[model samples]
Target chain A: MENFTTKASAQPLKNADELIDSVETFIFDCDGVIWKGDKLIDGVPQTLDMLRSRGKRLVFVTNNSTKSRKQYGKKFETLGLDVSEEEIFASSFAAAAYLKSIDFPKDKKVYVVGEDGILKELELAGFQYLGGPDDGGKKIELKPGFLMEHDKDVGAVVVGFDRYLNYYKVQYGTLCIRENPGCLFIATNRDAVTHLTDAQEWAGGGSMVGAFIGSTQREPLVVGKPSTFMMDYLANKFGILKSQICMVGDRLDTDILFGQNGGCKTLLVLSGVTSLSMLQSPSNSIQPDFYTNKISDFLSLKAAAV
Target chain B: MENFTTKASAQPLKNADELIDSVETFIFDCDGVIWKGDKLIDGVPQTLDMLRSRGKRLVFVTNNSTKSRKQYGKKFETLGLDVSEEEIFASSFAAAAYLKSIDFPKDKKVYVVGEDGILKELELAGFQYLGGPDDGGKKIELKPGFLMEHDKDVGAVVVGFDRYLNYYKVQYGTLCIRENPGCLFIATNRDAVTHLTDAQEWAGGGSMVGAFIGSTQREPLVVGKPSTFMMDYLANKFGILKSQICMVGDRLDTDILFGQNGGCKTLLVLSGVTSLSMLQSPSNSIQPDFYTNKISDFLSLKAAAV
Candidate 1:
């Protein structure tokens, strides 16, 4: 594969009017795009208002599976953006939706390696939650209560970020996979590490999930951005062609590559993990169709044109 | 590939005296076959003496790379087996010897993700060892002393089991691989997990090594058993015809598969991980040409006086 170079001259949309004129759907990345460490970005509300006034559909897609759509909706509402739970698509939501589409047995128990958001989503989707072995007495209660045991009735494994992972969790999960060859294995995202202040932290789900995949010689169905599953889900939900959707985010790898891989146009903002230098580097694989200084840049352009 | 099943009703050996008559070489597994839980098996010394009396060449080949040949030789010597360092072939030794054969750079630094033994072996073979990032202060010494500070000078990365792996190790190793695309990536083994404590505890090199491989999208040149590299090294070292060698071991996946893949006759012993039930089961791929209850059982079998 050839490396994509970001050319300064190829910057599209001299004004926001041109950008607004071409875009049908507006997709936003949660972290570092709309909010940073719990603080909402400036002009987010006005930006949403402008897009809404122009008849553009807003979708919040995040690689973080730690929260549910309902939780993200509340976070968005708190940030003064008018949004419904359906407009928020967290990785957990994508995972639950994919599991539901597969028609996994409702009575079959799911041993989750994630936060309450993933468990709640799966439970709402009619799956019986079988907590991991480390869940202790709670796991004992769920184990024999189901028609089958962990490895037997575990029809699917839904993995997301879990800070409480240990050896027991890995063993039990591996056992379930080994016993049931046909059982579905799903991971919210495959990002290796997440940024932390003291040091880079293990992005939990991916490591253990990857271990299972390697051991069992199986590949997990990833549900978050850059995987076509989520993009396809969005297209069907919004009834918009992929080309009509515009994915706006700050990170090039997840956000830009997500749109590019999904056949949607991508807009990169200079406010996240990726920077201009990284884009200029030989290693970067992602390139956006459009570039902006910030979300407010596009908003001010739209306002000035109007 | 089809499942392997055991051949039934082979004539029993009359005695140990008749068994060693036709045998020319003796092959042994290191971990469970020779010793278990830090204790040598009974009759091991007697068996070794009897084989030596018959002038059979003895070779101990192991998939475990955590220990070097010197360590294995010392262990075997402690167990009362008259083995020298040259007669023992650990995976680390095979890996180092294989890399040496390829004329890998002697002065360049190799990022090692394995035990001290592997690092020592690589160093003795003329490679400079750069331990994992967790080595912290120890890494500072290696960094300034690195033979090639230039971007392209890092020759290769050698991966094995490193229990103390962290994000920085993975990131730097991945960056080096990205910076030097031509740099070789070698893995001692691809085994996902190795059982310990009678299958109660499981650990393997794949977890850390796999993370780097996954991030870089590069497959490692495996030098452990079941890989032709080890067998080819053995063939070149001993000047033995491939067809004349017989690989005797207990595990079907590693030992018998190694022989079958290396074009050598396979002899499976039931004294270790694999059982008769597994041989009769419908999932095994590599079948042994000869079967024995244990390595000593071969000493009890003899060619008929026809």
Candidate 2:
């Protein structure tokens, strides 16, 4: 609250060194903070190198469930960054971790309403699953007796971003939840929209999850940023004190809220979906500890640069 | 409000004949009221015939958008009843009529997220369409630049009961609504769940509409029961007064609300989704004017029999 009304709160960073003073470990939101779509943001590589030279542990976290950590690492490598899979954390990983913590039975398969990333993580965690692209989601009539119970072994329905999402997948998911006793409903994230293009707003994973939510009349166990689930998963994985870590991202609803819920410091950058007016808006519920124009602005601190 | 607290309000109609003495118009809700699945409910034909002999105008209005009014009339004909297309009203008809009443341009197409009924109705009204099973709704990646704007001439997106709903349809519908200037969003009905089977709850057209609602963050013009749109269409088409009409159905939400909202008498039957306990429950917001075991119970009124 001390710097809530500071001039730098919605503009260029005033003191980059002061912001990083307490951030021993930096947790970054990928799509916006480090890169935009498939392109890396300006000065991101240099700023990241500076943080690495200053002995700050860097971790990349994203709600995108389309790609596994290994796949993300490959993208990072293509951008001239030496990031390993271990440095990457995704909602898919968090979902798998949460299910494992709950001792999800090995015999019962999870009905997936997502892509390959979630499947890879679930498999890595030694859990069997059904549905996804393999489901083919062959168009079926809405009439009864047309769609027979496809999978009786499904004990949970995990929904993420699925481009292959269809009526069949939704029907199967609803069936699994309504029929299977104690069937868990998990969601990677409930992001209403994704900033993929300027022409039109894209339906995020939340839309897929919303379909089930509307039909089943049930809420899902969301395992993503701003949910505290992902925050706890990261805390447990790194064994770090929340106070020593800082969450940096462009969105206030998800990334900044994740930091606030996790008891960590938060920084809001204006290079993505959020704008200066959004930060200054009175109706906004989330307020970050620090604000800046872009993540790359940190590279201007020549002392931190190698 | 005279019988708001009366015991008869929650009980089975003590005098079914007296209760229906003034009903000059009978608006029957198909599915559970007239038939279950494709089979006609026993006694429905005889009861309808009796009502017809009594000089009552019979109109079959259904929220099911899977079939057009012509197709529905054919079903009634097959069941040994003389019914015309004008005597049948469905959500799809209501949707098309609503569009026609508004004079939706014939040049701009309606992007459909429904079945043959909506398509046929739209076509009958001289409107071009770009969705349905014919669209194929080829599964596409959620990534940017992959889903090129399929149609730019869409002026509205009409959602009904579509078993062929896919990510592509959702994406296309969403794009049309978000990108196309002043694209009207319409839904046949927002039925949360349709009781088509006993095995599991089936998602209705509302589920498909829900995806667009979630993605576009917009409310649709719903054209089914309880919307007042369908009631207005029925009233205008038949030139009937609300007070002379009786809405007979099984659900308290759509059917009962439809009658109540339209200033007509309502009867909730136990033959379908709503139970006696549900009617008796104080927590229920909407209450019907009358309650019965089934629509077929009208046949048991020997004294009122024509």
Candidate 3:
């Protein structure tokens, strides 16, 4: 709803070459745009190799907080693409980076309501943490008036994509925020509709975030795709202007809106979550700069192919 | 907020005898009014006995679904009070009665996101149920794209005070409501704020209920305090007019508002969660018909004492 420019009309690329010529940096969303489920989409490796041959700076930006950047870096090799851990910026990485930027205390621990990815990142950033799935927090114990334990060292409560979220974890996080004075409530992502598979779309990590928000009546600092935090982090670290970057993603809400928020051009690919009809729908406020059938469609304009 | 009347001003009980004379039925809220934490309040047994001797029908109604009415009956005996299981109308009891009233199918099972109370009540009513603390649902397994299994015979999903509520249970219950056609979503309570101790107020079963509601975007048939379901059930079975009943509770929100909704007299007791300052605050909408420092304050006017 902000005063932002769309690409005049949502149309097919007439000159993909002209758009490609204008952008030096390419930001790609991982889930649907690169791969569907565990399998890589067709022409992904070739597309990455082609983009690199053209001397374009490629970066993989994902809202998946379940995996560390290191884990995601390994995923690139598994998908037959050569990429560094530095180029992969997951929500967990963004959360750790943001915490580092704010000069979060090394002595203080963060209580976690997420998976191992966020934990790994925080550890790499030199932070101590407690209460994840591995802890006894996830086990069922329904005794009357279950005493909620607390940690004095917990300075922040971080929530991400946690399959292991339970009453005790929520209670732990709520108590940490309420009981601990000046405790920071941080969420890794806020994707409303996350795709499990092409057909199955269950509630995302945002629902977990929304639960805490509802109970504590507090807002979380979401350091994910749609938030401008990632964009700022990317720009500051890479020394690239926002206008020099173009975001390519499958989902409209997080990926497209994220690019729009950063003043970067966005390309919506149909190989993932968003259908072509979603882009055509006039009710959608988040419109991308261009629409294509697949991420591989840009391959037609590649100089290496010619 | 409706066309209901307030006590105008929370005044001191000048004529306790006169206020006590109006209602034939006495409904008491268990947790703060009768008992504080695990221990029964001082003079609770004596006051209850005196009220019963006065030819007043006494009933214990609570939103807590952790213990069954039979279990609650044992607690009453432990606390040195003569209370029958029939005299207790816990949320679990209410849920069972409501299901019986609707003639819930014995063939269909209810998926539970709660404790043993509702499970016991449902079993007593000859209804099948699955998934509680004892069931394997509350434990966490963070495998990617974990397939959500479903019970084809699940006709309803019941939520209560689940200390073991996790993502899988929430998702399982959600899938039952969303995927299974005509599957009812039932909640034992909708307590906005519940506490273990007076000093601590954490997210209650309502927060667990809220997670499913937020995910499925479905409203549940709430069967607890502040809802008219228990009032209707008590009125029909006991053959007493709503006006004949007087509700005594510590909290203004659930107990007082429930009494007000049923057109019954409400007595706010200071022996529990609601403080005197809370009643005096104009910001609070619910007000009691009569207020005393403690439930035992009426003992001063008792004939046994006289």
Candidate 4:
């Protein structure tokens, strides 16, 4: 196990061809690396193709739980990429995988405070789930003689990135955690801001999860980045060693730290929310193993070397 | 200045007649001490009548921001208690008062993430406001080529106990705080939970505020209890002193801590969310100066003394 506590001095990976040669598998974070919102990043498809030709296994690990693996596969197709659903390890899938890993009772239902992705993933996983986009229009009117109620069958509340997030969902999730005995509070991820568009920042899943944390006063069992659940799941299912995997992402807190926590080599890219000043700031203690302009820099650097 | 850091041994105030006689003003927390939901606590009207008869100035200080001082005054009338609007200092009113104290520019508009009480309070305080119940039905569809827009005129975003809390409000607030230069984030109160009904726990203002905190990654300027903004407002507006005021309430974290933070004599009533076990627990560091069954205990203890 690597001592992640001691920060690795992030060096420029532009000249480090040997580092890339040693890795058999590459784990990617979507949104910033593959594309920025609706548009694909330049040279992403070519870089991925090059990696595929070199017999390197690729896994798309996204903290955005708004889309399931199937949806992500369609998105890849729309972006002119040939990524498959089998290689996409989205956070939405992680929630279902987490429940399956624990051998959750068949009768015990899950309450979702997310989007269609979480609901669809849970359905595919054969778990009875309720309360996601359906609860979007629900209102808790504190009228005279009004009483709030919760479903007793709710064994776990899965919180994710929800654009339809409202008070009813927040209160419902709160009730389950506070009232239900041994009810698990699970968070997809705690990313502060996500690249919703190439133009500006958008509130992430952490904002929705924060409401539950504040109301219930309980920390959630996060199933997304920085959590070893996905890493262990991938290791068991795909038979990949941590040393052979390199985690490439843009964010320091979630993406870069996720790799370091999973004992995988980390590469920080500057194409997303992070900047060079932010990466090198003394306050930023989470240092990645290598730094580059973007994932496509692999192709650019290799071409320049030739 | 009283050193509230050292825990004061909370004594049963059943026989503390002198403490009652010395207090010229009594600040009461309405929810647990006066009423539970719409039902008035036993002998609450009589207790207030007795306090008024003794020439004690009564002020209702509530952390619940769902109601403005005027709305709270109406609630008092509905409960058969004669608490005028002047006597009520709600957290919503505190938000408006905070803006007034800061001498906020008249041209700037305020964005609200709360109930009508906050909107009404801001209106009464002579501030232009938008985005409360109106934004409840709004949705952020992450469709192809979608863009989220926010008001540039928004100078402050006031978050309170909002039942209509949704992702639109969360995203707009996040944008204003993160994108706009020096845009203030104001929270009415950060109470973990509120007694929406005597039956169960309802998510409080903190839950809504937590969304903004998580998304914006900025600490809000809290104007509610334990912030001292309301305390100073009451002192200046009503010519009251902390020494002459006895703060009575049910919740230890909010009401009791608010009193202590304001340097007022504190009393904890067991009629609300807290239990005797929770209060007496060694881990409970927030000790009130006194403890009793409820506000009606003042009368019961007096009768027992006779």
Best by the DockQ measure? 4
Considering summed lDDT, which 10 consecutive residues are worst modelled in model 1 chain B?
Answer: B136-145
Q: Distance (Å) between predicted and true CA of B226, model 2?
A: 2.9
A best-first ranking of the candidates according to their DockQ comes to 4, 2, 3, 1
- DockQ value of candidate 1: 0.11
Candidate 2 stretches greater than 4 Å from native: A1-12, A141-144, A195-201, A277-287, A301-306, B1-9, B141-147, B195-201, B281-285, B302-306
lDDT tens digits, residues A31-61, model 4?
7788888888999988999899989999999
DockQ of 4: 0.61
DockQ of 2: 0.40
- Candidate 1 has an lDDT of 0.68
lDDT of 3 by residue, A118-226 (tens): 9899889998988876753554353566565789789999988677777677777888887899999998886655555444566677767866765676788989978
- The CA lDDT at B297 in model 2 is 79
- Over A84-165, each residue of candidate 1 has an lDDT whose tens digit, in order, gives 9888888988888998887877777787776667876786787787763235222211231222235588877776665444
Error (Å) of candidate 3 at residue A220 is 3.1
Question: DockQ values for all predictions?
Answer: 0.11, 0.40, 0.27, 0.61
- Chain B TM, cand. 3: 0.93
* C-alpha lDDT of residue B231 in model 3: 91
Give the Cα error of residue A262 in candidate 3, in Å.
Answer: 4.8
Q: Estimate the lDDT of model 2.
A: 0.80
lDDT of 2 by residue, B253-306 (tens): 788888888888888888878888888888886777778888767767555554
